[model samples]
Target: MDVRKRKTILFLGMALFAMFFGAGNLLLPAYLGYQTKIDWTSTFTGFSLTAILAPVLAIFAVAVSGNYFTDLGARANLKFAYLLAFVNVLCIGPLIALPRSGASVFEVAIQPILPDAQPVWVCVLFFGAVMTASFSLNWITGILGKIFGPILLMFLAILIIPGLFIGATVDLPPTIIEDRFYVGFHEGYQTMDVLAGLIFAVLLISGANRKGYTHINDKIEVVVKAAIFSAVCMLLVYGGLFYLGAHVSADPTEITRSSLLVHIATQYSGVNGIYLISILMILACLTTAIALTAGAANFFERLTNGKLGYIEGVITVTLISTLLAIVGVDGIIEYAAALLNFIYPVTLVLILSVLLFGKTIQNQKPYFITLIVTMLISFIRVLVNWFPNEEVFSAILNVLPLARFNLEWVLPAILTFVITCFALGRNLNLKRNQPF
Candidate 1:
């Protein structure tokens, strides 16, 4: 690659990193470390699979498909594609993720520093700025990657480096959980980056195209390379946080995720550390909000086939997100959990199916069948939570392989795809050889 393209890749990678490394991204791994204790590394290993690896693969899935989320989803069917896009936009956009980021900013970055400040105004300014940035969709990557990303990284390094040293000196406690890997793997779902990946990859590809990497080969090459860089950056930061949280000397059982992070910060650097964390978190929240808003706006604009203008879409998303932010973060999180559990497994199936089998399996039958099986299984899994006492729901999943691991959909999705493909191919052969 030429120097200009390399620069573009670096910025794109940084932008992607910033976009992914939001409030939950900051909180989850450290809390996992705090909880998992000596098994932190094993837990992080599992966490990395879904949190880091799956997201990068999702990006590649979109890149190879030669477009964004819609193209990949279209493999199943247009209606399914639109429905998936709409739900994903709501989950990751105005309804859940966007508001959650705004709320986090107020909780972590604002309230601690300015206890008297109203969340409403804070969110207004935040999403107002997000709206402004979304106006220049072409420049989202540059603004975040070139500016906020570097500052976020610098502050994060300042916070994690010494904390890691302090944590290293403290002996780790015995793990609280037996199934550390499974816990980490399951906990990784809370990050929600894999879902975000389907959306953000559009921004990256659009950004790449605007930067003159227009050819499909060049676009994929740039995106894939940038994804690798972003993945490495995420791994390093997450690993550092996990190791630091694992060796924390204080009792972490009662503390919340944000509290544990702040406690660790003060443990290493006192009051100055609080300010550092505040800055780190604000930038993290802002970067993520910007990306989410832009992606949602772009998605809706496209989803409507330009009936909803990009500016109008941004305004709508920002208005909804800001209003929800005022209602507080906790409720948003609770709402998101139910919605995520319902959609996450199915979305993962779609991403992996596209990435692994999309090129070879050109037919829609396998995609449709696999997705239906995954969705039905995921729906039952969600129902099991909603009606835990209902034996019908529990009994259905209890016999499925990997149900104990909370992955009841995997075997069924795979078998459905293979069977559908085999059946379709057999029928095609029979028709071809028929006398008529």
Candidate 2:
């Protein structure tokens, strides 16, 4: 890649980073910080691992394997790819995330300042305008490059500047959780960064390709650097929010699945702060929502034998996504998560399989076997959860054997990866493919 190209990659890369750093990214860290009160450091550990590592690994998985929706599901059927793509869009795009982004931005920035008797649709009307503006933009990359490219660092600074100034003014308190590190780690998982990371990998790959690197290796190198830029920003923001979370304690109830940051930032920054944060939040969310639409479109285009081009595919997806969003954020999230949990174990297994044997699926049966084994573990999790009352079948539960949390899936995924590695060692003739 030339200097101009490298600079282009980095610019788009950073913009992509800003896109996904929306409501969850902003509020969760601050809420986690607030929950820890004085134990922000400990809680942040949880936040970083889940929010940071998961997303990074996910992007790396895509780069390492060179797989997106269809490629990721190549081992499976095309139907699975379509399903996976649809569910992923719901999770990140307009359905669950976009409206929530608009809502959270308004709650933090707009709602507090209006006269008590004033209508609330001012914020809703504002976000509706945002949707229109985002739709009118040309290729998403163009929109992001223009909006996020220049503004990302400045917006990040906005959130952090206030937090730092406020932190110095107040005295730090003692720890909240008994084990801050573990608490932080567990809390980190709640952000679902790992899941988002997997989804973002497609965007990273596509964005890298748009810069026109002919070689897969060069393209991957670009992907890695861009992802690093994204991951680093996420880490800093999460850490700040975690520290912010530790500082204030106005309403624990405010920090539900949504609206965590709005509650906290509102407590400290006053009405002016809210307005600034809302604008920043809208920009970040818009970038992410547009990118997600593009990704889903790219995935579908590939999966359907090029039946639809990117533009047409995006329209189809956006229409469906907007309809789903109308059902509301809570429902959409539940629907996406339920489907994702089923697909992800298989998806994770396939990613490792591609890494292990992109060159010789013929030689490595165990890599193929690993998918089944890991999926069985994930399946058990689903099955256990399927039944609300295990006590109804005590004998059956005792006979089948299960973890209380159904988290045994983690062990099997690890075991499959390790076992497949051993198998690959036995079959040294297995082919190794290059990064594209």
lDDT digits (tens) for residues 98-129 of candidate 2:
55555554455454554352223543454444
Reference-based lDDT, residue 388, model 1? 85
Candidate 1: 10-residue stretch with minimal lDDT: 427-436
Off-target runs (Cα >4 Å) in candidate 2 are: 67-69, 72-90, 93-95, 102-138, 169-199, 253-260, 306-309, 326-364, 383-386, 392-407, 417-436
Best prediction by lDDT: 1
**lDDT value, candidate 1, whole model:** 0.86
Encode model 1's per-residue lDDT on 189-238: one tens digit a residue: 88889989999999999889988889999999999999999999999999
* Native-to-model Cα distance after best TM-score fit, residue 83 in candidate 1, in Å: 0.8
Instruction: Show the colliding residue pairs in model 1.
Output: none
lDDT, residue 136, candidate 1:
80
